[model samples]
Target chain A: MKKTVNQKAWFMVLPVLLLVAFSAVIPLMTVVNYSVQDTFGNNEFFWVGLEWFEEIIQSERMHDALIRQILFSSIILIIEIPLGIFIALHMPKKNSLWTSLCLVLIALPLLIPWNVVGTIWQIFSRIDIGLLGYSLDAIGVDYNYTQNAVDAWITIIIMDVWHWTSLVVLLCYAGLQSIPDAYYQAAKIDQASRWNTFRYIELPKMKGVLLIAILLRFMDSFMIYTEPFVVTGGGPGNATTFLSIDLVKMAIGQFDLGPAAAFSLIYFLVILLISWVFYTAMIHTDEENQS
Target chain B: MRISRSNWIMILYILFLMLPIYWLVNMSLKSNQEILDGFSLWPQAITFDNYMTIFTDSSWYMGYVNSIIYVVINTIISLTVALPAAYAFSRYRFMGDKHLFFWLLSNRMAPPAVFALPFFQLYSSVGLFDTHIAVALAHTLFNVPLAVWILEGFMRGVPKEIDETAYIDGYGFFRFFGKIFVPLIASGIGVTAFFCFMFSWVELLLSRTLTAVDAKSIAATMTRTVSASGVDWGVLAAAGVLTIIPGALVIYFVRNHIAKGFALGRV
Candidate 1:
C-alpha cells in the first residue's frame, strides 16, 4: 500500500505522542538526572559525572546478575522456540472443536496475572503440599526450590517454559494456518518426506511470526521480574536475581538511587539495542514479503 | 480409532499445560486444613469457604474491582489514541514517522523496573497516587505503544481505495471513520482491545508501585495473604483462580481472532 505525503497526519498522531511522552519521556529524564547526580539524605545533591556508571560497570554484583539474566534468557529461548514449533506442528490443523479447545487451554497461562502465575506455581510446587514437589519427594528425587539454587533455577526455568511456550505455539500455528493447502498438496504429490516438507514448505512461511515470537520472548525474559520475584523472591542467595530484580531492590529496597539509575540506563540501552536489531530484521523481512 | 504419535504428543503437552491450573483449582476448592494436611490429586473434601471469604471481604474483592477499573480505563485510552495514530502510520507518510513509531515501540520494550521509582514520584507529585486513574495512565507507557503497533498492522490491511472512496462519497473524516472505516476493521479493534486488556491485566510491577491502597490490584492484594500464621493457601488459591476467570472469559470471546492477535495483527 502506497502512503501519501501528509503533514496533517501529525494531528492524528499527537494524542499518542503526548500520552507516551508524559508516560515515558519525563520519567526517563528523571532517570538520566539521577544517573548523573549524587544526593545526601536531605536531597542535597552534587555532580557525580559518571562515577555511578563506573561503579556499576566494575561491580561484581551487576556482572553476576547480568550473566544470570543472559543465561536465563538463552535457556528460555532455546526451550520455548523449538518446543513451541514442535507442539504447533502436532496441533490439529483444521478449525475443529479440538483446535479451539487447544488454543483456549494453551492461552490459559498467558492470561493469568503474572503474580498469580507465580502463586499457582508456588502452590503447585511446594514440597509440603504441592503435587509436583510432593510427588518428586515421594519418588526419591531431591527437589526444593526454596532451599537449593539449582532447584530454584530449574523451577523458574520450567515455570517460564510452561507459562510462555504457548505463545510460540500460537504464533507458529497462525503462521502455519496462513500457508495455503496447495503447498502441502504439492509436497504430497512430490512424495517429499515429512522432514523435507517441514523444511521446505513450513519453515519459510513461519519466518515472520517466528521473528516476532523470538523478539517478544527475548525481551520479556530479559526483563523478567514478577514471576521469579513471586516464586523465589530472587532468593536462594541471589541465584535467581536477574537485572530487573536487582534494579528494583537497589532503587526501592535500598534507595541507592544513583547506581540504580545508572544500572537502569544501561539495562534500557541493552534492550533497546537488541530490540532495534530484531525490529530492523523484521521490517526487512516484511519488505521482502511485499516485493 | 487408534491414536497417532502426534495425538499422543498433543495430549501430553496439553496435560502439562493443564496440570498446574488443575492444582490451583483443586486447592481453591479444598479447605485450608485439607490443603495443608496432605496432597491430593483432587480435593477429598470440597469446600467453598475460600471463595466465600473473598466474596464477603471488601478488601479482598475490591482488588478485582480496582484491577478491572484500571484495565478498562487503560484500554479505552490506548485505543482512542492508537486508532488515529495507526491510521496515520498506515495511510500516510509524515515527518519523523518511522522514528516516532520505533520510539513508541522502544517504550514497550523498556523495563518497568527502570520506570518504577520515577513513576511513583511523578504520580505522587501530581497527587494521583493510589487512584485507579494513576495506574491506568501509568500503564499507557507500554500499552499505548502496543496498541498502536497492533492497530497499525490491522489498518494496513485496509485498502487505500476505501479512504478515497469515502472521500468521494462525501463523508467527512470523523464521519467516515465512525461509520465506514471502523465497522470495516471491527475485528481488528476487538483483537487490539483484547491485547490491551490482557497486557494491562497481567502487569504487576507498575500497578503495584503506583497504587498502594484503595486501588490495589488483586495481584498486589494476593501478597497480603501471607500473614504471621503463614500463607492462607486456600484463599490465595481462590483469588488466583478468580484472576484467571476474567482472562478466560476474554479469551473465549476472542478465541477466533486470538491467533492473529498473538501475532500482534500482522498475521
Candidate 2:
C-alpha cells in the first residue's frame, strides 16, 4: 500500500514530541550540562570542559562495571533465548482450560515488582530458612550467596533467569500463533522432518518478533538495577554490581555529581550506539525479506 | 497415550517458575517464628495475620492506592498521545518518519538510573514533585514509545481500505477512528495498555526517586520494611503477594489477546 505524502501528519505527531521533550530531552540536557561544568556549594558553578569525562573514561572501576554488565547481559540472553524457544515449542497449541491456566501461572513472576522479585529470592535462597537453600544444603552442595562471590553470581544469574525467561516465551508463543495452519499442512504434505520444518518455516516466520524479544531483553538486562541491588546489595564484594548499580553508588552514595553525569552520558551513548546498530540491521533484514 | 519429552521439559520448567513463588506464598501464610523455624514445602501452621496487617495498616494500604492512581494516569495519557502518532506512522509518509520512530525507541533504551537525579531536580524545580502526575509523566519517557510501537504494528495490520471507505462514506477522521478503527483494533489497544501498565507498575527507580511522601510507591514502601526491622520476613512476603495481584488481574483479562498473536498479524 502506497501512503500519501502529507505534511499534515506532523500535527498528529506533535503531542508525542512535546511530551517526550519534557520527560526525556530536557533531563538529558541537564545531564549534559552537568557533564561539562563543575559545581561548588551554594549553587556556584565553574567550567570543567571534558575533565570529568576523561576521568571516567580512564577510571578502572568504570571499566570493571562495564565488563561485568556485558557479561551478565550476555549470560542472560544466551540462557533465556534458547530456553524460551524450547518452552514455546512445547506449549499446548490450542486454547484450553489447561493452556490458559499454564499461561496465567507462568506469567505470575513478570507482574511482581522488581524489588519484590529481589526480596523473594533473597529469602528463598537463605540457607537457614529458605526452601532452595535448605534443599541444596540437604543435597550437600555447600551453597551460600552471602559469603561467596561465585555463589552470589550464580544466585543473581538464576534469579534473573527465573524472573525474565517468561517474557521470551510469551513473545515466541505469540510469534508461533501467527502462523496459519496452511503452512504446517503444506509441510506435512511434503513430509518435512520436524527439525527441517522448524528451521525453514517457523524460524523465518518468527524473525520479526524474535528480534523484538532479543532487543527488549538486552536493554532491560543491561540496565538491570533493583533486583540485584535488593538481593545482594552489590555484594559479596562488588561481584554483582553492574553499571547501573555502580552509577547509583557514585552519584547518590558518594554524591560525585560531575563524574556521575559524565558516566551517564557515556553509558547512554553505548546503549544508543548498540541499539542503533541493531535497529539498522533489523531494517536491512526487513528490506531483504521484502525484496 | 505416551508423554513426549518436550512435555516433560515444559512441566519441569513451570515447576521451576513456581518454586520461588510458592516459597513466598508459603512464607506469607506462616507465623514470623514459624517462617524462621525451618524450611517447609508448605506452611505448617497457616495464618492470615500477615495479610491482615497490610489491610488494616494505613501506610501499607495507602501505598497500593498511590501506585494504582499513577499507573492508571500513565496508561491513559500514553494511549491518548500515542494513538494519533501511531496512526500517522502507519498510514502516512511524512518527513523524517523513520528517523523519528527510531529516536523514540532509543528513549526506551535510556537507563532509568541515569535519569533518577535529573528527574528529581527537574520535577522539584517545577513543583511537580511528590505528586502522581509527576511519575506518570516521567514513565511516558519510556512507556509512550512502547505504546506507539505496539499500536503502530497493530494499526498497520489493518488495511487502508477501511480508512478510505469510512472517508468515502462521509465520516470525519476522528469519528471513523473512534467508532470503527478502534473497535477493529481493540485487541491491539488492550495489549498496548497491558504493556504500559506492566512497565509502569513494576518500575522502582524513577517512581521511587520522583516522589517522597505523598506519592510514594508500594515498591518504595516495601523497601522501608526491609530497613525497619532488619527482617520483617512474614510481612514482607505478604506484601510481595499483594503486589503480584494487580498484574495477575491485568494478565487474566488480556491473556487471550497476548496468546492470540500479539495483535501484529500483518508483520
Candidate 3:
C-alpha cells in the first residue's frame, strides 16, 4: 500500500488537530502554569520556581505512592498477560452459539460502570453481607478488605484481574482468528506437539496484538482510580493509595495544587516513556511483517 | 459425549465473571434491611423498592439522563473529527503524519488525574462548567485519538483503487466519501463508535470534575450514596445494576465486531 505524498491531507486532519488541541493543549498549559507558581486563598499568587517540584520529589508520601503504583502495575501485567493468553487459547476456535454466548458473558464485566464495579465488589467482599466474606468466615478464613491491608490488596488485585482479563482474552482471540489454516495445517503435517505448535506457529503471529494488549493493560492499571477509590477509598491508612488516587487527594481533597501539578507532570512522563517503548515495538513488528 | 478440558476452563471463567454481577443483582432485589440484617446467598424476600426509588426520584434518574447526554455528544464529536483524520492518515503520507499520530496517542497516555484540576479551572473560566458539552469536549482528548487509530486501520484495509474509481465515476470527494466510502467501512464506524461510547460511559474522573449538578454523571451520583447515611447498599446496588443495562445493550449489538475491533483497532 504505497501512499501518495499529498500535502492536502493536512486539510483533512485539521479538524481533529484543532479539537484535540483545544481539549488537550489548554488544560495541559494550565497544569504547567500551576506547577510553576504558588497560590494562597483569595487567588493570591506568588512565584514558586520549582519549589513545588523539589518538595514533591522529597516527599515520602509521593515515594510510597510511586512504589505502590509500580508494584501494582507490574503484578497486574505478570498475572493478566499469561492468564489472558491461556484463556484465549482455551476459547472455542469456531464461531458458534456457544462461542457468542461466552463472548457476551465474558465481556459483561467490562461494560459495567467503573463505580458500579467498585460498589459491587465492595458489597461482595463485605464480611457482614458479602458472599465471599460470609463464605470465607464460615470456612474459618479471615477475610475483610476494610480491616486488613493484605486482604485489601488481594481483593483489589483479584477484582482487577476479574474486571480486565477478558480484554486480554478478546485481543488474543482476535489475534488467533487472523491466523490462516495454512499454518496449522503445516504444523499438523509435521506432527508437532501442542506446545511446540503453539510456540512455533501461534506465538509469532500474536506478537503485535499481544504487545498492544500488554500496553493497554499497563496504562489502564497504572492510572486506575475510580474503582479503588470507591471500594477502599484508599483507606486502611493509605495502604491502597496509588499515584492517581494520591494526586486526587492532594489536588481536590487538600487543594495542594502546586505539588499535585508537579506530581501529575512526573506521572505523565513515566507513562509516556513506557508507552513509547511499546508503541515503537509494535511498529517494528508491523514493519517486519510487511517486509 | 464428555466435556473437553477447554469447556470446563471457560465454564469456570464465565462463572467467575458472573459471580459479582449476580451478587449485585441479588442485592438490588433485596430490601436494605435484608441486605444488612443477614448474609443470604438468595434473597430471603425479594423487593423492588430500590428500583422504585431511582425511578421515582428526579435526582437519581437525572444522573442517568446526564450521563447519556454527554456520552452521546462525545461519541458524535469524536467520530465527526476522526473520520476525515483517519482517511488522511490512511490514504496519504503527509509531512509529520507519523509524529502527529504518536502525539495524539501521547495524550491518551496522560493520566486523567493530571488533567482534572486544570480541566476544572479551564471549564470554570470559560463558563462551560457543569454543562454536558464540557464533559463531551474533554472526553475527545482521549476518544478522538482512539477513534482515529481504529478508523485509520479500517480505512487502510479498503483498497486505494476505490478512490480512483469513484473519482473517475465523477463523484465529488465529500459526496463519494458520504455515499461510497462510508458504506464500505460501516463496520469500522460501528466499532469506533462503540469504543468511544464505552470510554465515555465508564470514565468518571474528568466527567466528575468538569460538572457539578447540571451534568453530573451517575458515577458521581453513586459516590454520594456512601456519605453520612452509612451506605445505602440497596439503592447503590440498584443504581449499579441500572448503569450496566445500556452497556449490555450496546455490546449485544456489537458482539460480532468486538473481537475484530480489538484486532484491527488499537487494543
Best-fitting candidate, scored by DockQ:
1
**Leading candidate by lDDT:** 1
Give candidate 1 regions above 4 Å deviation: none
Q: Mind giving the per-residue lDDT tens digits that candidate 1 earns over B1-267?
A: 898898888899999989999999999999999888877899998899999999999999999999999999999999999999999999999999999999999999999999999999999999999999999999999899999999998898888999999999999999999999999999999999998999999999999999888999998999898999899999999999999999999999999999988887776
Q: Judged by lDDT against the true structure, how good is candidate 2?
A: 0.90
Taking the tens digit of each residue's C-alpha lDDT, what string does model 2 give over B119-204? 99999999999999999999999999999988988887788999999999999988999999999999889889998999999999
lDDT of 3 by residue, A1-291 (tens): 789999999999999999988899998988888899987778888888999889989999999999999999999899999999999999998889999998888888888888888888998998898989889989999888998999999999999999999999999998888889999999999999999989988888889899989888988998999999988999789999999999999999999888998999988988999999999999899778766
In angstroms, give how far residue B93 of model 3 lies from its true place. 1.2
Candidate 1, pairs of clashing residues: none
Q: What is the TM-score of chain A alone in each candidate?
A: 0.98, 0.97, 0.98
Q: Rank the candidates by DockQ, best first.
A: 1, 3, 2
True contacts kept of each: 0.90, 0.73, 0.84
Off by over 4 Å in 3: none
lDDT tens digits by residue: candidate 1, A1-291: 778999999999999999998999999999999999998879888998999999999999999999999999999999999999999999998889988998899998999999998998998899999989999999999999999999999999999999999999999998888899999999999999999999999999899999999999999999999999999999999999999999999999999999999999999999999999999999999888877
Best first by TM-score, ranked = 1, 3, 2
Considering TM-score, which of the candidate structures 1 and 2 is the better prediction for this target?
Answer: 1
